[model samples]
Target: MPLPRTAGSALLALALASVAVPASASSTAAAAADVRYVALGDSYASGTGAGSYSDIACTRSRNAYPALWADANDPAAFSFAACGGAKIPDVLADQVDELDEDTTLVSLSIGGNDSGFASTMLSCQYSTQSACERALRTAGEYVVNELPGELDSLYATVRARAPHAEVVIVGYPHLYKEGGLCLGGLSSAKRTAVNQGSDLLNETIAGRAAAAGFAFADGRPAFAGHEICTSDAWISGSNVHPTAEGHESAYLPAFSAAVSGN
Candidate 1:
């Protein structure tokens, strides 16, 4: 549940809204001057489906995009605070403490789990049409109405913890290839609904990132030809998580560009 929209929360929201966009030149300079990088968020950031897991609980993987990026860049100080199945509250409790004034770069992919993505997909798979639609509707409502405030609070917490960090918010990818090449037993229409939901997710992330002056890394182009249902799909059969190839090929490049201020 979101915090009560009381006077305190309202003031916090205002302060957070002012932080949506960082000064590009200064952020770029800070990003280069020091490299105390931190990674935070949910399953995508935790490398759930990607192979070579490092921690079972967090599911940090050598192949996860964050780990790969850390390896390539060799940041002076790096903390991988993301965990499998993390929601906004989880990030607030477990991850934000990793940030500090010395932190320079941060990358995150969150809010999907909060939107009940896994449950919604299960409902779409096993429930009747009406039931699936209801589930999707609930998820969409959470994304539109509730997620922004939660994200705003979380972003504020991160910024306060590391005031100069060049934060990067990464968005989820479309899961389907369109047409009749649908994966699993989902109807084409259902696939389209799921993909649309993903678009909503990306749009929400992009908007919030812009509001906070953070860079938004889009995953769609990287996953373009390899969405689920295609022979070249980089996503795992689980559908909710990306495969190792997906992490390496899609998320890694997108995050690299974001870090480089491209």
Candidate 2:
């Protein structure tokens, strides 16, 4: 005999509830709930030119992408250990201590300082065209040869420490909008060289991150039209670091998307 209408309705509701949420969805939600995030790396990660510094010595800005993401997500725990002028050695020595088996997420942006980014930019800006070329060449060589070994080492250490963490390697943006006009920054040639160097560096980092089974968040596209020479530039007047708007709009979105696998 057929069931009563009320009994049939109850059975239908029970059947729908049983398959309402997929296993993958439930697993993802649980993983998100357990997130223990740690942000690491150099000045870019520390928000050097983004301002509102919480630590002047380290240039840890409250407006940095890590902080912004942490604020938005409300992770189970967050440790912002990134600092200005941090090279791979510095990160290995200090920042890695912040990670452990409990860490569920990690984000990093490094390798530029190791390539002498500041001096290269200074040479590009204040010195002759030849000097800019020389600086860019040296940085490019370092990125191609030496950076891979250093990045591999760093990624290994991070994996050992944060055994279960989802690592996200964030990349730098092209400093200038090529083929754009600007009053007083790097010349077109210098800007092109600098942008090329940024590309090489990001490519190297992305490769190493992939080798380590980590996610790589490319920040270049995020700052496409908002480069240093653009009318509405996202980079600070320093022409290197991103501005507050850049962090909020560019870095934050890139990182969040990477973490969420979106």
| Each model's Cα RMSD | 16.7, 3.2
lDDT of 2 by residue, 1-262 (tens): 9999999999999888777767667887786689899999999999998889999999999999999998988788999999999999999999999999999999999999999999999999999999999999999999998999999999999999999999999999998988756778888888999899999999999999999999999989988999988989999866479988999999999998898555
TM-score of candidate 1 against the unseen true structure: 0.85
The digit string of per-residue lDDT tens for model 1 on 1-262 reads: 6666697788898887667555665676565557888999999888998879889988888899988987886677889999999999999999999999999899989999999989998998888777777888899988899898888888888889989889999989887777785645577777778888888888988898888889999988889989878889898756568899999999999888887545
Off by over 4 Å in 1: 1-33
In model 2, the worst 10-residue window by lDDT is 23-32
Scored against the true structure, residue 53 in model 2 reaches a CA lDDT of 94
lDDT of each: 0.86, 0.92
Q: After superposition, how far is residue 23 of candidate 2 from its true place, in Å?
A: 14
Runs of candidate 2 exceeding 4 Å displacement: 1-32
